[model samples]
Target chain A: MPQTLDRRRLLATAALGGVVGATGLGSLAPEAAFAAEPAAVEPGAPDPNFVEGRISKISGHLLLVTGSDTVLHSIRITDGTSIWKLHPTTFDQVAIGDGLYARGVRLPDGTLAADSVWVNIVNLHAHIAAVGRNLLHLDHKGQRIVAHVVPGRSAAVYNGTPAISDLSLLRVGRHVQVLGAWHPDTNEIDIATVYAAA
Target chain B: MAAIRGEVSWFCCGTAWGPCGTAGGGACGTCRSGNYQHAWPNTSDACYAITHPDTCGLSMSRRTCGFRHYTTNLCNGSRVGTTIADCGPQTDLFCGERTCCGSACGSNRIIDLTPAAFSAIGSLSVGLRPCSVDTV
Candidate 1:
């Protein structure tokens, strides 16, 4: 409770550097930030640096997660933890029953000091059934997915190249892996990054 | 066989969300989205006809369902063990595609993992990573 008050006070007084920006937000993306940190666990084993499951409970900055095999985990979200739902958001935006995958350092007390959390994030591989202006009609497996390209924010990486915003290279009948945030209970998604054939 | 150098991505199988709802238990019939399973491009003749990895000059021996293969994300040291549960990745569509991390690089789509299997090695959002597929 006291910590909450202190955080609120800081938020009210501090000049926020994070803005609803006009450029690529990859630098602020949690996954990229955490991706460099090598996993301390054994290969093919559960990575201590990552967590995945449904939200069982949220208490202040702590989140209780029921992972696979009903393994329960506690996640401590600090100010440093970048939470990306569809886009970068705050701690309050998280709600119960929402699925999440988190990457961070595991504290000695069995709590994960989260560096980042992706809520309802999905990665999909599909073919470009069609393409409209800033819109992509995806055929994932055999199902259709309507992926919206968020202007300025949405970018594409062609065959491991540096990301670029110009999607004119996106042609029909091409395969692509889309990185985006899923719309709750819907088939639509807001694209953040697209990895595609050049 | 030696580890095949290639790129890897993930797919949904079994009962899943959104467009993945239509995804059944894959070609193996034992596939599940939550299991450490994968889709191979060379599962059968018909499957090969669809994926056509050979069009890229990559020849793979026939591997049946339930065959175990290990995939290592070349970007990181993380690896995962999965069984063949489906046929996919339509390799010919993007024959010369490649992805790399630092000095290590891989080309062509050789493997497709289930969501459960993929999240084990790398974040789902960073799709299409360089990888090595092996049997051990």
Candidate 2:
């Protein structure tokens, strides 16, 4: 049956969910689809230009990491932070204990401005296996990652709201990019995602 | 939240009023029983803001409630000549014929003027364009 609902209450709920004010109306033209390239080794890691690290802490939204080369990096999650384009995933997939691989223009403060951080240290394809209150369960090549959808804050690529309630729309066969991070205190990933299908 | 892309002329449900797409609670195709619906948020309906408790007005072809001195009414004008019915919050249904009905109220119903033609009974022109009809 076609779903039905009250107009005022539903809109009120969306407002509570933080729907940004509306702007000018316009149609969004679809981008041309293309075949994706195979994964090549993403350069710029473990050096001054890049870094591979296990998450030391998730101090709120900021990420503290100790690099594989034995260096400490403080990463900021500011509004303009460019999440890694390679992984093509949203920030909702990041966590505290997963391994992080980042590439970006490093700041002089010895802390790198990360372009992207791979959660779990390894790349994987995942399907949106399930969704609960605030957690998204994903199956990646026989592995599972529970990604959290951070409310209110707009993710890097998905600025518009996502249709998360009806997870049934997320079929099992769809492939998504997976990134991971580690948390020293809990030694677990705090976020993850099946990258918004490339 | 449906991912609406590019520039599209979306409107309220069951009515041709607007470029309203997802702003406010109107956009999601949700309408209350006996109320109206818009797009986005995808679940409920909003009631029409009416003027004069019985009549309304239309702005830029969309419906709107009353502004200032004009007490909210269901129909735009009570004159015998035909015009549009002004629904509040910027909604107006066009009327077809002219009738000297005792009361000028059109409610939310778009009335038929004659057997062959019809025009809305309330005020048809008011407010600016899209902004009155559509959300961002």
Candidate 3:
């Protein structure tokens, strides 16, 4: 397994090198030397336990949502349901207009009895325009976004390597992807992880 | 048969924190935020029923645990292959949602990758990117 991983990493590195060379993005550097093997699946099926959308209405423990596809979903929150809004929170923390992704069981009435819910989670690909004491200026497409680095929460993965809490390896002018919780009504995000080439 | 084109996003699992504390390793039980893994919309019959890609005119093949799919960021052509660690992206939920870069555009949310996997191809803060999913 280790040998296979090494070979894969080497190939990935070569591929990355080719890309950087072609694009002249000299600042993009490889940070790790390992790549994971792909896993398999059956094909042509759907997952029945997950839901994602914006909270259109919240009444008691039930949430009325309008999916990105315009599908309507009724999600039920139970005592065992875990709701997250930037962190582990309660049902009360969920509000209208908040985006949500839920994983749980679908009841007979079509309501998703959620087991876990993540609110305002966003994953974006952007260029690291600048780096500050504890924040990063990112340019996604044409929009400038501010990503706050939470010391204990923020992590980085360089060149397909294990995640670490270090942010020093990150460089400005390099392209990076950020996984974070969106701060509602703002262009700022609380970063959970920064995927960079190092 | 061919590549599946759509938008890609990221999610957390395993050592969950804050809002992810209750995320518990995904529906497949092996999902972790640090691993090179991803969530597919079709891992089982039950899962398929929820994320029915067919609802949006997409005919996704049902793939179970450990199924590998290569996701390529359409913008930069950067690609990463990952195994299915859980079920996700609720394809129908975000059916018409689109992500784009330059002139390249991808619509719908088809896959949710782990931090380890997503970072391999693109930055996570950009929220979403147009991508192509293939089995190679």
User: What TM-score is obtained for chain B in each of the predicted models?
Assistant: 0.97, 0.17, 0.96
lDDT of 2 at A81: 33
| Candidate 3 displacement at residue A42 in angstroms | 8.1
Where model 3 places Cα greater than 4 Å from the true spot, the runs are A1-48, A160-162, B1-136
* DockQ, model 3, C-alpha based: 0.05
* Residue B88, candidate 2: alpha-carbon lDDT: 26
Worst 10 residues of 3 chain B by lDDT: B14-23
Candidate 3 lDDT over B63-120, as tens digits, reads 8888888888877776777788888876775556666677788877789987556655
The CA root-mean-square deviation of candidate 3, after full C-alpha superposition on the true structure, stands at: 17.7
- Order of candidate numbers by lDDT, starting with the best: 1, 3, 2
lDDT of 1 by residue, A67-158 (tens): 64477888877655677787778899998767777766666677876656778777777889999978899998677888999988899988
lDDT of 1 by residue, B21-131 (tens): 577888888776666788999999999999999998998878989888888888776677878889988788768887888888898989998765676677666677889
- Which candidate has the highest lDDT of all? 1
Relative to the real complex, the DockQ score for model 2 comes to 0.01
Clashing residue pairs for model 1: none
Task: List candidate 2 segments past 4 Å from native.
Answer: A1-47, A55-64, A69-124, A128-136, A149-166, A178-198, B1-136
lDDT of each: 0.74, 0.30, 0.67
lDDT of 3 by residue, A1-198 (tens): 452323322323333232222123222222111112222222212334456567889887689987654778888775545556655677777878787776555666677766456688766656889899999998874678889999898888664345799989889887676778876566478888776643
